[model samples]
Target: MTGTEPASGAAHLRWRPAPLAGLRAVAPVLVLLVALLVALAVVDPGFFDPERLLAFLRRSAPLVILAAGQYLVIVSGGFDLSVGAVVTAGVVVAAELFNLAPGLPWLVVVAVLLLGGLLVGVVNGIVSTVFAVPSFIATLGMMLVLQGAVFFWTQGAPRGYLPEDYRMLGRSAVPGAEWLPWAVVVLAVVGVAAVLFMRSDTGRTLVATGDNDVAAGLAGVRVARLRILAFALSGVAAAVAAILVGGFTGVSAQAGSGYEFQAITAVVLGGVALGGGRGSVVAAMAGAFSLQALFTLLTLLGVSGALESAVQGVIVITAVAVGGISWSRRATRTHQPVRESV
Candidate 1:
């Protein structure tokens, strides 16, 4: 057939892409999430009910928010292992604030917590970039430092209660619409903002920097600033998560424990590359939901809580291995040279 002529009847019909063609990065996790949801429905039919589902979402909001923040850092080619500790520290600090100033407004306390988290993120970025310390080591050290400080200050027992207005965000619903929890509202807002940010020029540049800093730098991407911006946003996310946690579950020294790993695993499961550059923010949040579902299913099946960490470790390792192989093969094909016909 000539270039301009129809080769066959097939040429007359326009090819329609698969429903999930545009969602290649998130397809696996989406499928997994659907499967998990189905299983949960089967095991506990009430889970699909509006009230129960809203309650579940209320509980899942913190982790989903964390995953979104973690997505920023991971996509920027770094880790923020200190976020969990940031959450803990945020809550403890807020409680201490109230102890020192019993009449302080909740809004002011939230602002302080957010500022503290931002400061922590700045420190993490500076240590990782300015001092040339690896993010892993830097964040891990930060985690230890924060944990130690919290323990020292609180003596393993946090004092003061979160004001009623603050707790309402976590435990209450909209005034007229009891069906909608404030936590869900916050999650929706955060999710929308994350999606919008990912579509912006800065977000695209951040991904490019994560994918290849040297190339991005050559293109005048301001790599260091972007990385720091990413860490700063992550810190802010952890703070927001802390507020939600403190509101819902009350203050505790261990409120934010294990969250860092959970966030990492959720991002990995969402098909985000560990080495950097790739994955959707929405998918990362979905990963958090999937992880939460998996845990819920496990609990229904009477699994031991002790195995939760083990399960997370296995998920992280397996996801990284699989993603690595897939990325390697794609890279190989992309770099393959074309040969001229003799």
Candidate 2:
């Protein structure tokens, strides 16, 4: 019994996690969110009112969804720079299709937009994985392609209006809580799905691939396929975001412009590793909320809207720098030499 007790104690000690390990993964984003909320409350005492809060969530939903999708790709060791273009394409294509056939059902139009986004993702994956193009370049080229196609199709001017039924997803309120936006429902669904997906085996495998593709492949993980899947998911997310954006803001040639950076920034701010293999989808979503809150605060403070881009640039750079430093410290600790006492 004494021998067994010692063995069990040793095993327990070996298996125990570091005190701060769990907190390290998610604390930054949570702290940022709380801080933002406090600041918002201070800036506008009514910011926490149920109606206003729900409206804020609704406004932030599209970016949150986009961040979720971006999280998948980034955690898989790739970037999806074309997502903004995908959003624009989705909106433009849907509008043009509806213009061509005004009688087309909104559901059908949505399906087409989703498929188009998926197709773009597939191409991105193939180009990056199969053709050996770097993800950054492949997605960038795709962005240009999509932008050019939209410009040609619209001749620099987008036309047609999203049907009321289509707009309802973004603008309508719930039946019982008329003040609550339907977008909250969409955001909830996407958030739950993202959380579940990350907890699944495939998600773990994807993270493994991101951490070290060579090791993951040797362990029988289908790295290429997972990368492609990540990009595809990102594309689908952009499409979903586009639906909400189109419905909420209506269509424009620049409807999705700069959203790619915003999604990336949000993901980084959430503490997701840039080169992949780390971060939580929930944190990434919270990052999105934080970003929106920051923007709102800035607006209230009378910050120029034109400086939004500059602020985003600073956020991205800071997040990346911090992540890099953290990674280096971890790596140093991992590779530090051990000495035996004489």
Superposition-based RMSD of candidate 1 using all C-alpha atoms, in angstroms: 8.3
Query: Deviation in angstroms for 209 in model 1?
Result: 0.4
The collision pairs in model 1 are none
In model 2, the worst 10-residue window by lDDT is 333-342
Clashing pairs in 2: none
**lDDT of residue 244 for candidate 1:** 94
What is the per-residue lDDT of model 2 for residues 134-226, given as tens digits with 9 covering 90 to 100?
A: 788899999999999999989999888788888888789978879878899999999888877876678768878887788989999888898
lDDT of 1 by residue, 69-182 (tens): 999998888898999999999888988998899989989999999999999999988888888787888899999999999999999999988888877877889999989999
| Cα lDDT for residue 268, candidate 2 | 77
Off by over 4 Å in 2: 1-22, 315-342
Q: Pick the candidate with the highest TM-score.
A: 2
TM-score of 1: 0.87
TM-score of 2: 0.88
